[model samples]
Target: MNSEGGKVVCVTGASGYVASWIVKLLLLRGYTVRATVRNPSDTAKTEHLLALEGAKERLKVFKADLLEEFSFEQAIQGCDAVFHTASPVKFTVMDPQTELIDPAVKGTIDVLDTCRKISSVKRVILTSSMAAVLIRQPPLEPNDVVDETFFSDPSVCIESKLWYQLSKTLAENVAWQFAKDNGMDMVVINPGYIIGPLLLPTLNLSVEIIVDMVKGKNPLNCRYYRFVDVRDVALAHVKALESPSANGRYIISGQSVTINHIKETMRELFPDLCIDDMNGEGLMDGINCTMCVDKVKNLGVEFTPLKSSLRDTIISLKEKCLL
Candidate 1:
């Protein structure tokens, strides 16, 4: 272990889709991780994390709840950094308030509450989404490419019935306000539609897009969206932690492609899959991606290419027998 180089850090939701990769990289980089999960004894939920390289020597797991105040205090005690990545992610739930908004917004406040009590903590890295920054509805012009400065209009999100995006926007808004008011050192990584090799066997909404594509779902190839690789997203979190200048929000993304473009790549890679291609010429007024990634690039983080991200996602799904 690089004890001199490593710092003890706490990661909330360590078994999560993106958080798993963050914990893996932290362990790989010699950082001792204090990981929090809903149920520590659930082997199926934590086995992938336990199998990582330095987990035995340096990783510790604890139970914490997003709603319970001070639930993270024990796990965060004495840690140098905290990565608060826990949030409920159901979009089609019967109750958006209980399933999405409360968890997203209130959970952030709960974590910040813990941070305020932990004097040993120096910096916090938040896993925010592009939804916090980009307006989903579009008659977007080419110049609509956004950066950290852009914030999605919460009203617009609600008007469009995009509960998930609104949840993220509100949650991130709370985080930024709390951080500023309390003088907390924080950085936000707003990633595009995240997709890559998931460490956990559980399905992620982003990876579901890949599965839908492989199964030749027509709607999957009917629109355009921006995407970033999960591996790149993980590295960005580490970079934000280590880089002194990485203070504000940074957008991490790779090239944006139409769904048709993605389907073409999938067709070439998995020739046996039944797939159809559409030009998607008029799809949402050519809104490939309404964001820019130059800010994150300035931090020396390179995103994985779109093709590679898709290919890896497919391979992972096949390995799990999900495709």
Candidate 2:
């Protein structure tokens, strides 16, 4: 790991929408990034990142899988920082523990184990989800927002079919526990519904929801919930990496609004657009559900307005022919 100028930082799931943005921002800032993808041979998955600004000299792609041990060592070798952003997120899995929990928890441990053996690795930035924090506590404290101190009890997070929340909560808890047990330096970023264009057309679980909503494929009969821009989420990841004082967890979300909030915003912003109204459950087009961003803002993150995010998302979908 290079602690001096232009330290190399490893980003897991480098081809993912959020991780790709993190890679992009790192390259723009002149930091060397070692990006890991499951398949190095898939040029389609990584070409956008290579074409990004400053990517030629600043980015390197490594083939790594979350299912394998020692796979991340080569990618993280000689890097001062690590960003673990790879996790499986699905609404319904026949076996939640196997399909979601195993990789989420085990992959984190594997990466940390690699870091423990490498003295050069000094810090770890984990990309968790707000579902790990907000889904459990029904009556959220109006004034007291979720911070690093808050956690979603896995046992109580079964209201939604999205078992991915349970996996994330468990994985984050394991990260903290491992950090404490091994005396490793680590920080976690729990972002709300992330919305933005992908570096590539491929979808990771987080961005897939927004894409599906725009495409009128939302199966969840829910009301609205908080959302954040992928750009802001990427910025937060890099910020957490550089800020020495940033330790523990930070909630990163855009403005709060329900499904209706998104629909109305899009309707006003782009009158020609035909956005479908999903008759979902919790945050259906009728309610207002949002989150407080004091934590990440304190770390110097600026969130994009929800309207802008929705507009950009539609544009992205159109460009990708997903619309």
Candidate 3:
């Protein structure tokens, strides 16, 4: 194990699919990690985290709720760095404001506020989604190449009822403002659709899409699909924290392909699995945009190939009996 010189860090939403990987990587890199989950008593949510290598000696699980103010204080205190990955991710909800926006915006502010109070905390790495970069007003052109400069338009999100996208955009916006106002060192990682092996027994929304597709269910409605491995996303967070020069927002994406391309690749890899195509019914049939990963690559992240990611995802699902 490469010693981090007794560096201690805090990761909020530690039980989550992406955050779980982050905790595992941090622990493996010899960093003492304080992982905060909603319920430490819930074995289902925390067992995987506890089971990771080096977890017993270097990992501590704390209970934290996003909506509860000052709940993250104890978990973040005395930490050298903080990774704020806790956010509400509901694509469709009856009350978008209460179910999505409130938790996302309030939870970010609460975490940052706690970090600001702690003098030991030097840097913060926030996990924002591609949703904040993809959806925009007037819509992106087919030839548009999206980079860190692009941001999802709030007006378009509100008018189109893109609640999840709006929540991430608003939360990230608030985080930047709060950090600048308080002179905090903050780096944001905007990852594409996160897919790969599951550390938790449960399935996240991104992995669930692949599982649904394998079961002959068509869950994809977008013409363009962008994906990155969960492990890569986790590594990006660590890299952002370790690299002193890492600043601003970095877009971490692996592959950009079409729905048909995904279907073909799956069929080629797992011919036995019953995978169905969308039959050219995608919402944005002809519209396509590229996600620029040049910024993240500069962080020394060699992205895991999408084919390998898809294969491992299927293998993991089969092992978990979710396929």
Best-fitting candidate, scored by lDDT: 3
Task: Please write out the lDDT profile of model 1 over residues 86-127, one tens digit for every residue.
Answer: 987766877778889998888899988788888988899999
Against the correct fold, how does model 3 do in TM-score? 0.96
Candidate 3, residues 29-115, lDDT tens digits: the string is 989999999999999999999999999999999999999999999989899999999997778799998999999999999999999
Using all chains and alpha carbons, the TM-scores for the candidates as numbered come to 0.93, 0.90, 0.96
Tell me, by TM-score, which candidate is best: 3
Tell me how candidate 2 scores on lDDT.
0.80
- Of the pair 1 and 2, which is ahead by lDDT? 1
lDDT per model, in order? 0.83, 0.80, 0.88
Question: Scored by Cα lDDT, where does model 3 land?
Answer: 0.88
The all-Cα superposition gives candidate 2 an RMSD in Å to the true structure of 2.8
Which scores better on lDDT, 1 or 3?
3
Candidate 2 stretches with Cα past 4 Å from truth are 1-4, 137-144, 158-162, 211-219, 277-290
The root-mean-square deviation over C-alpha atoms between each candidate and the true structure, in angstroms, is: 2.3, 2.8, 1.7
On a 0 to 1 TM-score scale, where does candidate 2 land against the true structure? 0.90
